[model samples]
Target: MNLIKVKGKSENSFDYIHEKWIFKEIKESNEQKFKCKSYKSKFKCPAILQKISDEYKGDDSLHNHPHPVIRTRMEPVNKMKVPKTTRKITASKRITIKPTVPEKLKEFKNLVTAYQLIKSTFIAQVEADDGSCASILSTKYCFDLLGKAEEIYLHATYKIQLSDIKISQILIFFVRRNNIGIPCVFVLSDSTIKSLYAKIWENLILRIPSIKENLKRVVTDCYLPLTFAILEALPQTDVKGCWMNYIRMAARQWKSCNLVNMRHEVLKWSFLIPSLPPDQFKNAIMEINETIRDKKETYIEPVTEKFMSFIKRWWEPAATIISFSNSTNDSINISEYFDRHMGSEFGSLTPDIFQFSECIKRICDNSENTWKMMERGAQFELYEKQSFIKINNHISNNLELLSDGKISLEEYFKQAMTSDIHELILKILETRQYKNDVGRLDEFHKN
Candidate 1:
C-alpha cells in the first residue's frame, strides 16, 4: 500500500499501486520530491495492496464488532519499591527521595525487562560490528536495571549487515497452564516470505539454550508473506496473530469503527497469559477469560445512532492522521527508537497505557504517574480535574493492586523474588510491574 505524499495537494486522493509500497508525496517549499517509494519496497516494508488492505480494516471496538486485535510485547523492570510509609509521616519528613516513576517510564522498563529476561532466557541477540555487541538490540544494559525504561534499556543504532540473514521472529513462552500443553511459541515472521531471515531466529536460539524446548507459538500480524515465512520455519508452532499490523487490509471503508474499545479489556488480558508464569499467572488469566466469557454471554452491544454522528464529526481529519503513520507500532518503539522518534504514529499513548493497565493490572510505573499522563492527554475532556484526583487517590489506596506501586515495598519484593521468577524476568521487575494476574495468580501461587 502506498501513502503518496503529494505537493500543493492535487486531487487529494490516496491509493496503493503494485507490489511496491508506493505512497504519493509532494516537496515542501524549495524541497526536492517528497518521494513516497524507495525505488521498490525496502527490506523493512512489505508488498503493496496486502499492507493497505490490512491497515483499513474496521477497528470499531466501541460497537463490539469483530476486528483483528493488535498485539506487541512491552519491556519489563526491577523490585525494591517505595512502600507506603506505615507511619503517617508527611512528604517533608521523608529523608530518602522516593521517585514516583511515570507510567511511560514504567512501561518502558517492563519492555526492557521482558526483553532482557527473554534475551537471557533465549540469548538470541546477535553480535554487531563491535565484538562487545551484546545483542541485535542496541543496548549495553537492560533499562530500569537502574530506573526508567530508557535508562534500563539504552537505545542504540541498528547498522544493517549484509552478511547477516535478517529474519524477525516473535517467540512466545508460557508456563504450565494447569499442566495443559496449551503453551507454545507461534513463529510469525521469517526471511524468505517477508524479507525477515530465519537465521535471525537460529542465531537467537543458539544464544539462549533454554528457549529450545519451551518454545510454543510463533505468529505475526496478518502480513501474508511473513505469515507464510512462519509456516516455513516452525510448522508445529501455532501461528496466533500480529493483528495490529495486518488490520490495514482487514476492514477498510466502514465509515467508522468502534470495535476495539469494547473488547479492549478482553484483548488486554487474554494476550498476556502467554508471557507470564504459572498458576498465579493463570489466576489473572482465568479472571480475564471469565470476564470476557461472561460479557460475551450477554447481548452484544451495538453502536447507537448518536455515536455514528459523533464519529463523523472527526472524519475529515482521519485521512491526515493515517497518512502520518500515526497508528503504526508504539507498543514496540517507545524506548527502542532514537531520541528523535517515539516508535508509533500515535504519539499519544493513552489508549495503550489504559489497555496495558486493564490487561496486566499495573504498569511497572506507579498508577499515580500513569494517571498524570491520562490527565495531560485529556483532549477529549476525559480527565476532568475531579476525575483525576479520584483516580489518583483510588490508586494510592490500592497501590498494591497497582502492580509495582504497592503500598508496601516489601510486598513488591515478595511478589518479585517469590518462588518461580526466572532471572531474566526479575531484571525487569521494576519496569513493568508483574501483576499477580489479580487473584487467579494468587490461586496458583497459594496452591
Candidate 2:
C-alpha cells in the first residue's frame, strides 16, 4: 500500500492515505493509532492501524466502498485572517492563527478552518481554504432531541460553495424530524463518489441507529453513485429515485438533443416514462427513440443518436424511478428553504466556507426552537405546489391500478402519456421551457 500524508478535516489534524483509503489519527492516546475514515460515515468500517516506533500494526480490515479519488491540500484563507489590533475589538473577536502548512503541497494549498461555537449542538463545520469541502453533522443529540422518521432524503445542492475551482455540489440528507423536514447531515466534497456517499450514510447511521434500524426508504435524485451508495451503506433500506429530478433531467436533455420540433409528441412520453413499471420503462424509452429515428429527416439522426446514448447511460436510475417513493417534493422544499435563508444571510453571491458554515450553524442552532414549537402543535409543513402533488397522486394511482390488474399496460401508458400530466406536456410544448442538462448527457456518454 502506498502511504500518503493528507490534510485531515481540521487544522492541526492529519490523515494517512494507504491505497485510496484514508485513516485518521486516533485521539487521546500515547501511541500512534489510526482508524479508517469510513468510521466517520454511516458505514462502520473495521479498519485500524497502530504505529509503534518505526513499525505499524493492527488489523486493517477491508473498507466497504472503493478508494476515493480526492486530493486534499492545505490552502490559505486570506479572508479569515485575524484583524489587526487597532479597532476596539473584544477578546472573543480576535482570531487565532495556526502554524504554517508545509511548502511541498504548494499545488493543493488551502487552510482548513473549523469553528465550535455552540455546545451540545449537533452541528460542526470544517471549511477548507478554497471552500472545496465541508461537513455539517448531527451528533448523538439528534435522536435524543429531535423527532424521528423512517424516510430520508438525500438532496444535492450545487453552485453554493465558494471556490476558484469548479465545485460539483454539496450533499444534504434530510428527514421529517418533528413533522418538518430538517437536514441531518450536510457533506460537501471536491468530488462526488460512491465511497464518500457511502461513508456519509454510514456516519449518519452510526450516529442515529434508528436510520439503520427503522429506515424503510430513501429518496434521492437519479445519481447512480448515490443510489448505489445508499444501498451499500444500508442494504435492507429501499432506495427510490426522485421522480421530479428524473423528469427535470429528461426535459434538459430533450432540449439538448434538439427535440424541440418533436416536443409536442415527445413531452408526453417524457412525462409518461417514470409512471411505467420497471419492466416497461426501458421499452417506453426505446419506443421514443424509435419514434425519433423514424422521423425520416436526415437532421433528426444526430438527435436520435443523442437520445439513444442518453437511454443507455440513464438505464439504471430510470429503472428505479417507479420504486418506493413517488416524489421528492419535501426534499426540494427543504433545499429551497436552506438556499433562501443562505441567500438572505449572505446575499445573492456564493458564500465562502466561513459564511457557508455560519449559515449552517444558524440553522442548526435554531432547530431546537423549531422542534420545541412543533411539539406544541405548531405545524411546520414543507410547502409544495399542489399541482405536483396531484400529478404524483394520479400517477401513483395509475401504477397501483396497473399492478392490481385493474388496467392494462396500454391503458396505464395512455393515461400516463396523455391525461395525467397534460398541463406539463402542454407547457413544455408551448412555452419552450427547455435547456441542456449542463452537458451531463455528453459527459456520461464519453465516460
Candidate 3:
C-alpha cells in the first residue's frame, strides 16, 4: 500500500495510519517528527500544527479537508471551520439611536461613515436664537457637540431632489420668523454637483410668494457654469466664488507636474494671509508665479499669469476670500481633517440628500462655520417648503434693511421669527413621515 506523505512542521514526516481494519494507530516516519499539535487530519481527526492569526496553514488541512463542508465542523479542528468574525469599521461608531433599525425605515447611518459623524460632519439645528415676529424662533443651528467644534463639513449622499413642496417645508423650518421677511440667502457647501443638488434650490424659490429673481445671492465652489446658472435663475443673485476653488482650479489646469514645490507654495500663500490688501494680494501671487517661472533647474512649467488675472479681474463678493483662501492649507487641513475621519462621502465632489442634510444640521449649530460659504456668493439652495420662503424672505429683507442685508446675532435676540421654531420643527418632523436617523438613534441610545 502506498503511504501518503503528510506535510508536517518540518516537511520531512507523514502521520500515516497503517492499513488496519479499523481504529488503527497512526505512526509517522522517524525522520519527520514534528512538535506543534494544532493540525488536523482527514477523517475528522485533529492534526498537529500551530494556530496562526485565526488560520491553520499545514499540508493536511489544505490537502485533506479543503471543502466548504469543512467550514461546518463542530469540534472546530475538523468537520468544518468557519472564519472568525471581525468588527467592521463604519462612518460613525454608533449606527442608530433606535434599539434596532426597523425593516423599512431609512437610516442616515447608511449614508455616512462611522468615523465621519463624530469627527467630520457637524449636525446643527436651532437650539436657541428664537426672536422674530411670525412667532418663528429666530434661526439657530444644531448638531452633535461631542467633538472639538471646528470646520465641520456637510456631504450629501444620493441626489436629494428638492421638490417645491419639500423646499417649502424646509424653508418654513430654517427661518424662525417668516413675517419680518426679505429674500434670504440660503447657503450650501459647493463640494458636490450644484445643478443636480439645485433640485433643493428649486424648492426654496417656489416656497415663498416672492419671484425667483428676488433671491439675491448664491455662494459656491466657483465652478464657471454655476455662475451662469445662478445669474440666469436670479439675475440679482451674485455668484461668489470661494478662494479654495480658484486655487484648486489653477493647480489642476495651469500648474505643471514639475512645479510640486510651486504648487505647495501657492497653497501656502493663498490662505496664510487672509487680511492682505487687494494690490498686495495681487503682488504676492505674481511673486509666486514668477518664482515658478524662474526655477528652471528644480521645476516644471509655471502656472499661467491668467491664474492671477482671473482672480484680480473680479471684485465679486468672495473675490478677496478666494484670492487668499487656500483649499490646501491649514484651513483646508481642517476640511480634509474632517474628510479623513469620515468613512464615506469625502473623496468625490458630489453628495446625496441624506449626507447633505446631516452636514447642514451640524453647520447650523456651529458658529464659526455659519454661512461661511456665503462669503463666496456660491450657487446655493436650501431644502424647505414655500412657507419657509415667506418666513426667510421676511427675515432677509427686514434684516437687510435693519442691518443692511448682513446677518447679526443681536438682531435675532430682539424678536421671534415665526411661531415657536421648536414646535414648528416637531411639526416638520411629523411630516417627514420618515424619522430622523439620529432621532431614531437617540431612541436606541435611551434603550
Predictions in order: lDDT: 0.28, 0.56, 0.31
Q: Give one digit per residue, the lDDT tens place, for model 1 in 1-447.
A: 223332222244533322222433333535322233332322121112223333422111111111112222222222124334633355555423322323322123234343333233222333323221122321112111111111011121121111212323322222211111111121212222232434444454454444445445443333444445445655555543322221212122111333333224333332222222222333443454445456664523243222222223322223232121221121121221111221222132222322222222111222223323333431211112221122223323333353344333323223423232233222322222111111111121221
Q: Which stretches of candidate 1 lie over 4 Å from their true place?
A: 1-135, 138-195, 242-246, 252-447
TM-score of each: 0.22, 0.56, 0.31
Please give the clash total of every predicted structure, in order. Answer: 86, 12, 96
Top model number, TM-score: 2
Error of 3 at 226 (Å): 2.9
Model 2 TM? 0.56
Per-residue accuracy of model 3 over 117-158 as CA lDDT, tens digit each:
322342211111221101011122221110212222212211
Question: What would the TM-score be for candidate 1 when compared with the true structure?
Answer: 0.22
232-321: candidate 2 lDDT, tens digit per residue: 888998776555566666665666766765445655566566656567766667766776677757445666667656755665464664
